[model samples]
Target: MTSFNTIIIQNIVESLNVGLMVISHEGKIIFLNKAAGAILDLDCEQHLGFGWGELFITDEKSNAQFNQVILDVISQQKVGLKHIASYTLKDSTCPKKLSITSSYLTEDDATLGMVFLFEDITEIFNAEEREKKILSRNAALQKERIEGLDSLSQAVAHQVLNPVTVIGGMANIISRKLPEGDPLIHDVQVISEEALKLEGLVAAVHSYCDIPKPIPVVVSAKALFEEANKSANEILDRIGECIEMKLDCTVDKITVGKKLFHTAIVELLLNASNFTMEKITDVSVKVSRSENIITIKIADHGMGIEKHLLPHVLDPFFSTKAKGVGMGLSRVKKIVFEHQGTLQIESPGSGKGTTVTIELPCPDLSCCSKKNSD
Candidate 1:
């Protein structure tokens, strides 16, 4: 009577939250709790003796897989298996993901039947996917914001630079005429120097935003040297120091933009000058070609970048200088990337100086870069 009277035991399990079912070796369901009946939408009182195929609905492929899994369990092919079933309603609405676990039951070393449990895991999976999409969207928005700021900065810098130049040139003229050791001469010189730094900051803003479409023409090593020297001369005169250009070019007459290439070299020279630790710094420009790639390397004996800060030097608006806008290296990086080239920055420990290298496809081996319509 105790074995046959399972009403009390079944009632206890039926009160629980999770769904549970026990099936015979013939795939016939012997008992199911209230939760299982609700999950499968079955009337446990009327469907207790029904086979799984009659109690549940599924497509042909899934039905076959389900029957095979039950066969494997009965034959002891595996101790347990798990399957996720997605149920679609008549209205085509899908709810939480359902996880079903199937395992065998035994008593006294004899197979009794199989037990199955089900749970919903939809909330957890959907939350994780939503988080990933939010992160991707945030990154895209940040990029757009920075581009907008760059456009605004370029407009403002142009308006400010012209008057700053006039102020600097006037100060230079006054300093040149003043007799040596004049009391006011030193003040004027200081004004001239600060103006020059301001001018550099403005130029950096312009460069950072002004990515040109290159108009390539045949350019020689000597021509590059001259442009760099001329650009650096303004600051050199202000600092009352000089550095020589050490050039070693193996290939001459490489095709590149005359103005843009010169501008990049000059920017490197000015960057070197800004970091000089000595009263005088030595700078060198080296050119070499390997196979179809040409390399231009500029090395300077100046205060080297700190180990930690080197990686961020090319990032827009990231700078060590108190008054700097941090656009110079970013501009150089943009120009190199547009030319299908690579830029590298290398530094020994602080105070040991640094080297900047740029590599581009050799125009002699390849054709000249296509000129932009602009």
Candidate 2:
């Protein structure tokens, strides 16, 4: 009968998935099961008579804390459970996380040694980390989709409203000229112009929503800025100001889709021009390169963005402008991200002017040159 009971106990210990160890009163390991040996990266025979602290190495601070827990368990002569704690093995390649439950062994209510049950939780921890990353990525994608839909709606509303506004203004003007014969004629012409403007706006919205396939090529930064500035000549002249372009980058070329790059630069230029104070003499565009990053900064001396609004500027449909549809900066942000870059806006509250900085990963000139030559 005693032999039968001993066999059953051995079978139970061998079948357990959790690691098990029995420690003497002197903190020495007296018994270890196969699972415990595997966790400590040792054979059961090799682990016997070794100190628990030596088998599961921890820092001085952690060792002190764990010793206190063991003392408390021994004094109370009760079972104690501790949350999973990480331990770095001295000679193992992988870290181990374990939950330890300790209980004192007693014979006729007199204390003897203690038994520790160790459960490895490393795989559970890794799965939780992976799940967190997946959730984070899904959240970001959902936010982008919602923002895109909102921008589309705003663009449509702006397109519809622009023509209606133009037509209304023309109707008011022609009301006084009704007696001059062709009263409705001027209104009709105005409506046609307004309709064309709306069509152009709608086209911009379509292009923004359905991005074209990328045609990657090396584009000259200096040449692109020069062309964009020239296109904005009329606006500069009307505003009685000059845009100063400071090109400090040695790497003149970047790999990008030419048309999209051109549009991004133009949009930034237009934004700068529109936002500058009339008395401000210059809008500065500075280009520089450092390490493997290319940076472009556009600064305007205008009534700067409000401090509270700066955080939300890149959000779709969020605008400080009285008349804007608020998609310009949002579109710029999207384009910069597509190019593996970041866009940041800095301002000192309301009256201090604003600066928009764009940083893009620099292209490998060697590879680009080889491709171009080929």
Candidate 3:
């Protein structure tokens, strides 16, 4: 009965879908089950006593992460479990994803070898990758459609501007010539004011359509922010509003188009100023860097957007304000996209305030040095 039970256990182990292998402390393969041989495409009987390096390493390369798990189990008595690794086969261009778990093989507290349990997770990994690619492609297509619309709108605005300007000028002239008590004067004044507003909108649309490709230059981030703040202050002064912006920046330098970057900041600052219901709005600007990303966050104590409207903020001609043309954020979005950056707006709810975060890619510092030398 004991012999029959042992045979049953062996059969169960051999038939497991999970691949299993055991290697000695000296890095020699001691056991390779049928599942392991099939997963690794190796003959278990032929590689029983072969070294790990001889069987796995090819062209001085191997699944270093997967092998390290087993090595740690053998050398340091460390157990690694459920670690995923990318493994490229000997002649295959595509890599396979492997889910590996490793533990010690011991008998009566004496360490004999290491046991590795692993399974192919290529299909699962590929599925996740496909989903990511689909999301990315969808975003790209949406951007293309928006940009195409922008191009068409700009052309229409350009064509309408000449006639609008003539209409506005003629109305203004008629208003100036008419008697003060004339009833037609009021009508002409309304026409003139509306035409001027339309002209301004057309100019804005034209500018948005004609944003030049950025010429990136390495500049001090602080300096750029300071310049943008000064410009924003000037605009605020013109509009009879005063703001005190608090800046906290950790990143020293960044590569960006000066005019384009400044425009992006100024647009956000103006938007923040406009939305705040308070007489004096507190705007906080924080710039930080992590790895290869430069993050700039502008937060404002303002009338925050509704939850449903957050996604449409970047859409052209979408606005929450009564008189807003809704082109500011869309223009900023275009600038951010041209710089290969991402923008996110977050707000808890109405009256809670808003935070706009922009992340730009930062290349290596060495590249900056190279460009400076050149």
Best by TM-score: 3
The residue pairs in collision within model 2 are none
What tens digits encode model 2's per-residue C-alpha lDDT throughout 171-279?
5666665676665767666665666556555555655666554577988877887887776665667857656655444456777777887778778777776777664
Location of the lowest summed lDDT over 10 successive residues in candidate 2: 61-70
* lDDT of candidate 3 over 241-319, digit per residue (tens): 8678899988788889989889999999989999987656689999987767889999998889899988999988887
Model 1 over residues 1-374: C-alpha lDDT tens digits? 56645887766787877788889877789988888777756687899988876655455644454455555666663556787655433333555456778887878977777898866666776787799899768756755775786789888888889988999999999999999999999899899988888888888787677677788887776777776777777678787866677888876667677777777777888888889966566888888777778888899988998999889988877888897878888887767765667899999869989999999887654432322111
Could you tell me which 10 consecutive residues in candidate 1 have the lowest summed lDDT? 365-374
Q: 2 or 3, which is superior by lDDT?
A: 3
- lDDT by candidate, in order shown: 0.76, 0.72, 0.85
**Better model by lDDT: candidate 1 vs candidate 3:** 3
Weakest ten-residue segment in model 3 by summed lDDT: 365-374
Top model by lDDT, which number?
Answer: 3
For candidate 1, the lDDT comes to 0.76
What are the TM-scores, per candidate, against the unseen true structure?
Answer: 0.46, 0.50, 0.71
Number of the candidate with higher TM-score, 1 or 2:
2
Prediction 3 TM-score vs. true = 0.71
Give the winner by lDDT: 1 or 2.
1
